[model samples]
Target chain A: MYVTLKDGIHDPQGKAVKDALSVLGFNGVEQVRVGKYFELDIAETSLETAGPLVNGMCDQLLANTVIEKYRYELIEK
Target chain B: MYVTLKDGIHDPQGKAVKDALSVLGFNGVEQVRVGKYFELDIAETSLETAGPLVNGMCDQLLANTVIEKYRYELIEK
Candidate 1:
């Protein structure tokens, strides 16, 4: 799962990181947007059941949909 | 760039998310590891130059090599 702040939203954390990089002498950096990524180990389930399940999980738990958005990809293990 | 906690590292934040998921009835999750993803818009440059540059940025500022490691993919735009 990846949860990123909506476009046009201020990302102070990313700004801080970019600033730090500039201070470290990396001048080519034009912009930086930071987001959260998650690796989830889940029990085996059908894709049909897993899609809504994970969507619910993201909307209800992992991300704040009002200010951020999330997308997930599932791989069977 | 993707920055993830090294294996065996304790992640209380990920643990809290897992616990919350369990309490919210999404119990199929066995593990949750959280990480950071960075989308960087950098000046157009040759891949050879970009590779070492981004690696240096990650090592020096984006990730703490002691506990976190980072990998990045470059795309021309």
Candidate 2:
């Protein structure tokens, strides 16, 4: 799961990171926004079943849907 | 860029989030590892050119190469 701030939202942590990068002499980047990425080891085997289950997890627990949006990709392990 | 703890590295924040989820009654998940995701608006246009530049940012400032690993995708914005 990836949870990122919606566009137009201010990201103070991202700004701090960008400034720290500039201080470290990396000047090639801008408008850095930060978010959360989760690597989940779900008990389910099928993507068909896991999708909604994970969505429920995100909706109820993982993401704050008001200001943040989330996306997930399943990687077979 | 994404910054995640290497395998076998303990993630306290991830554990906390997972515990919070369990407390909120989502119990079908396990091994929930969390990481940092960055949406960077790089000044460069070409992926070929931006790849190395962003790699430099990760190496120098974004990721702690010792315990964390990073990967980035050049999204056209």
Candidate 3:
């Protein structure tokens, strides 16, 4: 699952990163947003079934849906 | 740049997140590895130039090359 701040949400961390880049002489950088990515190894065999299961995980704890948006890519191993 | 724990590098945070998922009843989760994702808005027009610049960022501070591997995708806006 990929979790990122929702659009219009203030991202102080992102701004801090941007400021750091600027200090490093990477003045070309206009913005920088940081996010969390999770690679989940799951027992489910198909995405169709795992979708809701993982969604529930995110809804419950993996992400704060009110301020963060999340999406997942399921790959069967 | 995406920064993640190198294989064979112990990830305590990942373990903690996995444990949390297990407690939350997402038993289907076999493993969970967390990582940092950065979206950089840059002034450079071509990846060829931005590539080295961003790589410098990662090499200098964005990632700990000894225990973390980083890769980036260049998207034109």
Top candidate, metric TM-score:
3
Model 3 chain B lDDT-worst window of ten: B23-32
Q: In lDDT terms, how accurate is model 2?
A: 0.87
Regions more than 4 Å wrong, model 1: none
Residues B5-36, candidate 3: write the lDDT tens digits. Answer: 89988888889998998887777777788999
Top lDDT prediction, candidate number: 1
Candidates' RMSD to native: 1.2, 1.6, 1.0
Give the TM-scores of the predictions, in the order they appear.
0.95, 0.90, 0.95
lDDT of 1 at A11: 91
Candidate with the larger DockQ of 1 and 2? 1
Instruction: Please give, for residues B15-46, the per-residue lDDT of candidate 1 as tens digits.
Output: 98899999999999889999999999999568
Regions of candidate 3 where Cα sits further than 4 Å from its true position: none
Residue A34 of model 1, lDDT score = 93
- TM-score of candidate 3 chain B vs. the reference: 0.94
lDDT of 2 by residue, A17-44 (tens): 8899888877777788999999888778
Candidate number with greatest DockQ: 1
Q: What TM-score does model 2 achieve against the real structure?
A: 0.90
Deviation (Å) of B31 in candidate 2: 0.6
* Clash list (residue pairs), candidate 3: none
